[model samples]
Target chain A: MHIGRIDESATLGDSWLHQVSPISKLLAFALVLAAVVLSWNVLVIASITLVLTAVAVSARLKGRLAFSLSAYPALFALIFAFSAATSVLGGAVIVLKAVTAALGAVIVILTTPYPYVFAPLQRVVPGIVGDALLMTYRSLFLLIEKFGNLLTAARLRAGLHAGHPVRSARATTRALGGLLLYSFDLSQRSYDIMRMRGYEGRLRVTLPRSAAPLIDAALVGGALLLAATSLLWRVGWRDLNPYSWIVLAVAALGLAAAAASTWPARGRTS
Target chain B: MSHIHIPDGVLPFWLWAAGWAIALVMVGVAGRVAGRSEARRKVPLVGVVAALMIVSMSSEIVPIAYHVNLSVIGGILLGPALAVIAAFIVEAVLAMLGHGGVTVLGLNTMVIGAEMVLGWALFHAILKVIKPTRAGIGAGIATFLTLAVTTTLVVGIVWIGGGGEAAERETGALDPSTLRFENPFEEGLFEFGLFGDGHGDEDEDAEGERYLSVGRFALVVYTLGPVGWLLEALVTAGIIGYVARVRPRMVFEGALAEEMARIPGDETGGH
Candidate 1:
């Protein structure tokens, strides 16, 4: 799953995006999402996508990995795009919308810890639901690890025979059943541990006290600018058309520059 | 598998907004119901089940392009009240992971939650006629039927949202209508492209562009859906059957507790 990779990048990165507060990032994401939804112009969406790609690059994120994660949405959107039976440009716009939205999300997730991300959400949702979301996120890594181990053990025990689909499927299902039981036991233990630690009905998640006001403002400002641009374009403001092209070109160039800067330097081999 | 994958901006605002409003209401109702029960104890279980759903949903069976939702299994284990909450969590996490759009979280949750609730109800209903040993068949039947219902739900959602005039204004295609082809027999069935050339009419003017229509979308979905449903049903059946044999109490925990208890010496009685 992309979760592990995303977790690693979020926790280990030292870029500007990594330094930005999670709440700020989320707000920015919301604004960008509003822009994407409001605008139908290909150039506007493409510009937003280009700007996001540049942001991803500036953050030193792996372009291939980010795009790969976004590819699922792109593939599904392709179907709907065709189903819409619009012009080729229209189809491209649909696909771009999906990719751009996915990329925006991937950026936020890749830069913030899961706990930090969910901390804000805990306020809006019910306590039980919020706690469950946190627990689910926490337990996913453990369960995925256990699932991998089970698959490996099944292979070693010859429980999974590639040539025998039926037998393999049966074995897989049984393993999953066992996994469910294990999960139940795990949850019971977790509950006990939480109780021991005095984890009342609600989990208290404290956001870090440290702040990055300037970076946060910049991110939000950039998001607002993007949204304003989209809205203006929708409202017959054609004056920004030439500048949109300039923005796209600059974004593409910035992305290329970021990529080149991050590329590994060649070492002389004696 | 039954979730609508139409990304963030594609769906009509009103449709998704209504979906959110309805989903919130359902979650509120479900939350209240769960709160009256052993919600504190069930919280962890809900988490584990939600995690499992996420794992299954994220893993695709490549050849068929299907993901095992495991929603029915989750429903069976978590029960309907908590299952709805789990569905919300799963959809939220999935959206963050780019599996679907964040805006459609409520709609996706409603679809998957329906599958879970319907599956759980169907399983117990079927158990009335069949022996506990044949629980796999019960689960299989429930999964298939629930999948059919939810898949139809997805089609309905698309049909309603696909009629956006904004889409027409942007794409130059009229609102989604009936499926049509310029010349089906002459072009040959195999010659049609699902992804290429946008229906083999590249040169068609904006007024004449071939509208894929919701009917065609449904045709494609129905064509590909049953295979996924059958596969998921089999997997669910095998898993449930295995669990029922080893831990009958888990399968017959809440709703069937009284019924199974009536059967003296039955392992499902949780004695």
Candidate 2:
């Protein structure tokens, strides 16, 4: 039952996370993902997942963020159902790792809009490729809108109750065909507009204005600290694993993140 | 075509990384060959087609744990190069949406891109020689080849991922039969499944591994893959046939566009 866009209400709210630079969030997420992939310990992975979810909460994504986490486990639980008993633990670990990595990423996307996220890439890549990437990003939402409308219309035409499977499939294909033509027309018009503006393949993007380096640095450091702490706890493991120390540290970090996210700050009310 | 519905964190980092690297190369090549206008036109086309793929893949068929990938349709429309890039974008976005795993975006792209590339080549080749109107025949053959490649890819990846002595160390070594869940396929779905008489995997499998070994995985793929191919072939063929009749240029005269002027004296020069 999980449903929410990745960038839901990202630009509307004035959360401190929204003010943080997208690059900082991106770097932090990259670190979190690296930790999730490299670390095989279950407690450490679970703690990282909890820590990121807490950060998401701090970033004001609350239920939708939590919903995304649950979705991963729900999907893997089915695979666990069919696999042999020996593989269940391995599968569970994989599930935890996936949830942790994905939630960490959602934290970035949930806070930053497309403009900020792509601004860095737009600057780094060559003109044509960068512009193409930006164009694709812009067109995504438009396509999504049309797709939703077509689905609703198709459902209505089919009476939303009883349509043969074949008929329903046919309706879907027809809608997609319409979407295809619509997109082609849109592309032509967009190109026309591009030419009218005396445009080359270059698209200019505004950089972030509210650059809160301290707060952004703190967020990145917190994730890195957790990952480092987990890494530290994993060393000399062939002799004996110290799960308790890592667990206590992770719990403390998660709670602190949660409290900070919820704390009342300037220009904000809880 | 076959679609890898498996979530992330299962395949090793090396495998997924390789998948991403190869996919990136393919995208780069596509970009290099494309003209400015062609690439621009493809942006919106890819976006729209990607939306279609996501919608189709996200909707579950449930009974067989299968979903329509629509890679063949994307291939037919966008051709090989753009289809590969579009499929990668679509998979990456789906991964972000928590549909698939981000780690395996590379592998998923490869699988889907392979389907798209093969399907594209086959569709155009088949349509050029055959009556252009009978694109369904081309679509059907292309669909079969696409599925065959993708399914084999999935099986090979699983097998390679599970290889070596460290495999058992990777996962616990418990007897699978000792821990059994309720089998939903007791009566079989639409008379297709691994349940009827006592002639299931256990009867033929020698290793008797707890989870899916290479052999059992292959059997499952072979048994169920045809159904998917048949359905996709029918849909792809129908769509191509319809599009050819209404708008011939979109797909009809792709590989055989030059032949059009010679054979039918039609003058819609291929883009």
Candidate 3:
């Protein structure tokens, strides 16, 4: 439930939310997201994010998911800063609207875990097809990490020795070609492994029934109250951090703790 | 290309809602058919392609004021369903980053979705017929068409939102200014000054009606379409070419792979 770095174990809370159907979370997130985008008032945006933060904390989400979710607002703030510096016209208003809308959506994505989030889609989609799609989506994170590693490795080995345009061109071409070859081989091996595991014409997904009445009510009620309050505030607040700076300070401490815990054994292959 | 920045509180809620409805329907239809097929394996590649688009668009070529979006290539590489999802994430991130307006996310999604759908379908069909010696060219043409059609769609949507229908109604009237009526400002001294003098005169309406017709807006959009389309085409072609030359097998490994293998002339597709 902490707002610092995601702890992977943080989502182990006993809240009724983890029991809800992923479909409900999807619908909740999508609806709230649409509503937020339709609004321009800063207060409403802040209220929605605040409410979602409360729910996420209650869910006790731990790892990267929690950290990533909370980071959405900060990301928006960065964008706003850039736009304000460069833009001549209504930059301030536009930036605030973007931040608020984005924050509202992030709360939804963050509070609901990915596995739980995709559960509803499986039931609606039918069989292994949904499961396959979900698996495919998850695999991307691993694949990207691998690709980044390969690119880094390639950069290091290639060095900075190319002298002329001809050499530089050859080096660049070789590196790209090598990357493509590597990716193709990796994909083929993965596809073969998938086939070996009985992947076929359909993707199957199984979801356990989890949502309780209270959790459903809480999510719906919280979203509505936030939306109502936000609409009433119109557009007055301008400070980027709606929360006191102390909250950020606390979050920083938590991140430091999480990072330190993982540092000693980090990158140690099992 | 100046981002077509639609701020919040500009379009009515129903307009954005309509976009959501259409986007959902498109995703559903695309997902149902594509999800179970062999193409499903390629769907996750949408994320990689989306990342590529973000990097590509961020890197600008001189003389072209607009960043290269190349969403059409994404749609081509990973069909519409996955492409739509990719575009959604990219556009959402871009809007959140204030590269575009947040309120316009729905509209932007629809615009990018159109490019994916139209380009993918057309590219699929074209490759079937022309059977280009180089699969990369097929991808290039498909990307080009999608970008062109999607840009036109954007311009049309903008013109309509700008009150094209109202302008049409005021077309025959004497005053052109009536055709370009601005939405009243919610508050302030400028709002009062603009309307205050009790200037409820009908004669002024006649003069207002004479300017800025729906036809003029259409003309401007149509005129600019080609330039936008060409820029998109060149950028996409360049990127696809780079990908193909670097890793031809990756491009050849999808639904198109079998087709590439069967083609009489080529061996190994690429190095």
Candidate 4:
């Protein structure tokens, strides 16, 4: 909870947590989120949040990264309070569901690198698809940055620091117009860049022979297990959220397996 | 603002499966459309449209605390064929980014597709009637129509989904006579007078049996709906107005332009 310039040195190493496959973390997060959404038990939600917090700590995400990721749920919780006051009791459920799910996702993001995380999805989907997704993500941040630049340029050129609301509107609109032109030009240049790369209609990538088959099996098995468990929950296994406990057990087993594999090195690192 | 936040498995299996099916169908349609037309020629334009949709949806308006999403405006600007493809791709990609739900890709696509097609139709219909001189006015009017249509669809979906849940819960547990209104919050107002009714159904239903009433859910959905619309309208107006001023020909389909050219006073209105 300390504000301003918290240390991030803990995240510097290429430890086992950093080395774990992004796809694995993605699956774990999916399991926790699925469990949270299927059940209404506040206990399960809180427990899962705590569990994810532990994972976050283990992953070594601290300071700004930690705060920015976790603060979303709190923001939604504020909205939920207002919604609860105005409406039915359902708002609380919505908030809880959102928070737990977000916590699960945050754990994955904090544990994994951006490019490596997307690499698996890229392999599963096509190269063109991957390129498209990369473009989309890049474009969002690009738009923000470009918008800021446009505003700054407009201010400099027009010498309009602040003015009447109507004048301000005109200036803003003009800046917006410039942004549109810039965005379009950038998009065209991007298209040309893609063309030069021999992109064709699709992008293709060959997976590494090592671990690829095993990873594929694990992913398929995991998806099937999630689907099956969800169906089971629907068919009268109703309790105060049995799914989260199951997920917790599964997560514990996964960690145990990893720890066992690396038992000899644990004390050495610590 | 109007981002679909429901996680996978929160929805019924049927809902998720249906969404995936719809996504597949759209992909097929897009492929077919791309095959017939010069897709490579339009790739740059599609890229721009995709960028615009992403930017529009991500921009949040202050004080209102809502974000924008204008799949409808994309539909109007890009036309239904390309719009559907863009909407589907956008939702699927955003789902991975955690901005929307993965399972509801189909539903999100459907909702956005509806907005796009309807908005496109509405925008053209309004343009034909008003024939405004200023591109800003036309863009603004078109955006308003798009937002209006999309908002109506959202309200309709929320009401139907929420109403079904409330009815099912009530029939399974409560007295038949007690379930009067579709929305539980409005029902609360009726029963407790000021939400302090000693026998308010909320408390009674708060345990394992408790679920969100259609009315209560509606209140939240509606509360956020306008904010989403306003943000979307502003972004759309800004982008489209910019497009119209710089490249007006890009917006109108050749058919539309030809038809407008045939009409009286078209030259005066034409830029």
Candidate 3 docking band: incorrect
- Looking at candidate 2 chain B, the ten consecutive residues that score lowest on lDDT are B182-191
- In order of lDDT, best first, we have 1, 2, 4, 3
Model 4 clash pairs are: A127-A203, A128-A203, B19-B106, B183-B215
Chain A only, candidate 2, TM-score: 0.83
User: What is the Å distance of residue B236 in model 2 from its true position?
Assistant: 2.7
lDDT of 4 at B226: 63
The residue ranges of model 3 lying beyond 4 angstroms of the native Cα positions read A1-31, A34-38, A46-93, A122-133, A157-190, A200-216, A230-270, B1-11, B31-70, B78-109, B117-149, B162-185, B188-239, B242-271
Q: Which stretches of candidate 4 lie over 4 Å from their true place?
A: A1-18, A73-90, A109-131, A155-170, A206-270, B5-13, B41-44, B70-73, B165-210, B219-224, B227-231, B254-271
lDDT for each residue of candidate 4 in A123-166, tens digit (9 for 90 to 100): 54433344454465455556667766776776777635665655
All candidates: TM-score: 0.86, 0.79, 0.58, 0.70
Computed on alpha carbons, the lDDT of every model, listed in order, comes to 0.76, 0.61, 0.48, 0.52
Instruction: In model 4, state the lDDT of residue A14.
Output: 50
RMSD of each: 7.0, 9.4, 10.2, 8.8
How do the residues B82-185 of candidate 1 rate in per-residue lDDT, one tens digit apiece?
88988998988888888888888889989999999999999999999999999989999999999999989998887776654443443232212332212211
Give a tens-digit lDDT track for model 1, residues A1-270.
Answer: 867888999899888888888888999999999888876666678888888887887787866778888787877777767665334655776788898899899898888888888898777777778888899987898888888898889888888988988888887787787777777766766766787788778888887642678989999999999898777655432233335556566657767876676565212211
Q: Write the per-residue lDDT of candidate 3 for residues A180-258, one digit (tens) a residue.
A: 3444344444455556777664554464554586676666665555444443222211221132233334434544564
| Clashing residue pairs, backbone N/CA/C < 3 A, model 1 | none
